[model samples]
Target: MYENYAQRLAVVYEATHKPEDFISADFEFKKMMRAGSCSAEDLRCYGILHHQMACYCIDKAVDLFDKVIGQGKAVDKDVFWRTKHQKMILYSQTGKAQKNIDEALAVINDGSEDAEDWICLIAAYSYSGDAAKAYEWILKAIPKFPDKAALYVYGGDTCRDLKKYDEAFKYWRKALELDDKMYDARYSMGFCYEELEEYGKAYDIWLDIARDLEEDGYEIEKQFPMELAEKCKAVLTDHPA
Candidate 1:
């Protein structure tokens, strides 16, 4: 029975790599595992599925991750590390900043200092209000993952947190240079301009963001950029050139 379910899971995994498709598969896998006949490979596959599902269904993702971790040495080392990394990211998203930081550092200490690990470390440190540390780590990580736009965005965020708006702008500008479609960098640049009292520049950036979000059909994200654009417009109105 478990073998049949495992084969079905493999079919689902191969059919579509989309996250939404995996959510129902993850639920089925969990139910099958509860029947106590799953193989190590079955659990490993389930862990991978759950990790991908984290973007849409966080609580179930965490539970599946915990189940995988509880398997201990039965799980492959690479799979375990991947699970830990995903768990660290989940912790960050769920407001467990300190846990995110600690888990990311632990993964690094365990000799997994890949790009994902560095990115997670930067985010965890920034979220924990240790922007200085996040900046330091970003610098260290740049030489390794020089082309990753997210690292530069984190650098910008740390600089902004320190109130160094000019420096933040430079970092975010570099990030946009690497990935022109990186709206987060554009949004951060707008924030830097706002902090520097450059209302016109900030307004233009937010206006672009609002338009982009609307065009992309990102309804929730569209609201923030629209609000920021309006606020910047109000500022511009108050102080005309």
Candidate 2:
């Protein structure tokens, strides 16, 4: 069945969110889909494949998610709730605060308690220019799921965006403590240092992140840390710091 191909694509997606990987997955998915074998599972994978930073991808993902939501009883209860949750996340990326909040509220009540729900709800508030609410919720969430490194990374993001650099630093440090391999939190810390004009500190963190990425088998040449490291090095070379 086409669901088999869709399952394979889902595995690849979980492994890496690289656009190239999605392109490769799309090839197989299309072959199966065009054969008149498309299933609800295939549709879900298709939606996930297009969920990225591109504007077109966001619109397409939302449409696909909406279609999947309309499937109602055809989908499992849990899968249906997760689908709604994902749609809420994509809506937050649309840059509409009220709409994002409404979608977020709907999904949380749709019955699937997950760490992702808390983080996405926090993100909805943060990206919607309501960092105060995001901050309030993060404080509440950490005590409940203290070891969720992803939550801390998102909390760091909210603090950084609010110009609370020190609080952001605390959040990132806690995140790294929980998951030493959390390069996202490390990058956030590096960005904060750069924002504070601490070129030397930023340079060191960037170099560390580059090494971490390489250790994780990522190509440093294609990674953002190396790019940041190069830029920070140039700043240090000129300023002697």
For every candidate in turn, the CA RMSD to the true structure comes to 13.0, 12.4
Error of 1 at 93 (Å): 8.9
lDDT for position 6 in model 2: 61
- Per-residue error for 121 in candidate 2, Å, reads 0.7
Judge candidate 2 against the unseen true structure and give its global Cα lDDT, from 0 to 1: 0.78
**How far in Å is the alpha carbon of 191 misplaced in model 1?**
1.7
Q: Please report, as a residue range, the 10-residue window in candidate 1 with the lowest summed lDDT.
A: 1-10
- Looking at model 1, residue 132 earns an lDDT score of 90
Tens-place lDDT per residue, model 1, 30-90, is: 7777888777877777777766555446766888998887887456866875686667667
User: CA shift at 156, candidate 1, in angstroms?
Assistant: 0.4
Tens digits of per-residue lDDT, candidate 2, 1-241, equal 4248666865686577666777777887788788988778777777766664265467768888888879873667567756866776666666566787766667677954666667767877876788899888888778878889988998899999889888899989989999897878988888899999998999899888888778778884437888898998898899894
**What's the TM-score of every candidate structure?**
0.62, 0.64
Model 2 lDDT, residue 16, Cα: 73
TM-score of 1: 0.62
